[model samples]
Target: MPTLEDRLRNCTRSAVHLEMRDEYMPSDPRFTAWRNGARNDPADSDPERRPWLRLVADLVAQGVEVRRARIVSEPVSDYIRFEHHLTVPTVRAGEQVRWLPRRRASGLALPGNDFWLFDGTSVVFHHFAGDGELAPDDEEFTDDPVVVKLCSDAFESVWRQAVPHADYTLA
Candidate 1:
C-alpha cells in the first residue's frame, strides 16, 4: 500500500479532507501554546516553517484543488477554536476550508470516521481514541469505489451546508 504522502503526492484533480473531531492531541506543542493564550498570526511572514504548507502549495501549483471541511459541536472546544483561528495559513497555501456546526450535521449519514479523499478515488480514514487522540498507525486507506463514493457523497453534503472559513464564527 502506498503511504498517505505518496498518495497525496500522486493525486490529480482534487484532494478533500473532512475532519470530524472536536479535540485531537492536546499534548501537541501548538495546541499547548494555544491553551496558554497564544494567538496564531495567520499572516506570519514565515510560511516554510511548516512542511505541509510546502506540500499544499506544490499540489496547488500542479492544479490539484485541495479543500477541507470540519464538523464541530457548538459551544466549540478550545482546540476547535484554535484550529479555526489557524486556518488562514492553510488558505494561504492554496486550499479551501469550511466549517459545519454539528447541529446542522444531524440526519446526514456520515462515515464512521474522518477521512481524506484524494482525486475522489482513494480514502484515508483516520481512527482516533475515545479522548480524541489519533490512534497509533491507525490511518486506513482504501481504493474501493463503494467506500470512496460513500465518503465523497457524505463530504459533498457537509461541504454544501458548511460555512466558508472566512465567514465562520464560533457560537
Candidate 2:
C-alpha cells in the first residue's frame, strides 16, 4: 500500500492521469483564492509555491513521461477555468496536458472514476464526494490486468482525441 507520492517516485516509464470531474478540492485555498480574483503568477518558479510542479519536473528529468488529460463540459466550470489558468507552470514543468470536451467523449468507453496509471501497469483510482472533496479513504489501487488495461486503453483514447493545453480554449 504505497502512497501516491511513493508510487509516483517509483514510476519508471510513464504516468498518465485522467481527470473527469468538473471540480475537485472545492475548498482548496488555491481555488478559493482564484475565486476571489487572485491568480497564479506564471513566472513563479518557487517549488514551495507549487510543489506539484517540482514533482512533475523531477519525474520528467528522470525520463518518466508524465501526461494529464481532462474531460470537461462545455462552458466550463469556474474550477476548470482556474485549473486552465494555472496550467502554464505544469506545461512548463514538462507534463503534456490535454482537454477533451465531454461531448466528444460520449462515444468512448471510459472508467467510472478518474485515475492515474503508472508505467501502464498499476492504477490508482480517486474517489470524491458530492461536494468535490476527496472522499474518506479516497484512493483505490490495483494491479489487476483487466483493470489496468481498461484504464490504460481509456486514457490513450482520450489523449488521442484531446486538444493540447496550449490549443484549448474555454467554451
Sum up the clashes in candidate 2: 0
RMSD after CA superposition, every candidate = 1.7, 1.3
Query: RMSD in Å for candidate 2, one decimal?
Result: 1.3
Q: Identify the leading candidate in terms of lDDT.
A: 2
Q: Candidate 1: lDDT of 36?
A: 91
Weakest lDDT window of 10 consecutive positions for candidate 1: 40-49
By summed lDDT, the worst window of 10 consecutive residues in model 2 runs over 39-48
lDDT of 1: 0.88
TM-score between model 1 and native = 0.94
Q: Which digits, one per residue and each the tens of the lDDT, describe model 1 over residues 107-159?
A: 88899999999999889999988887779977998989999999999999999
State TM-scores per candidate: 0.94, 0.96
Instruction: Spell out the clash pairs found in candidate 2.
Output: none
Query: Candidate 2: lDDT of 92?
Result: 89
Off by over 4 Å in 1: 41-45
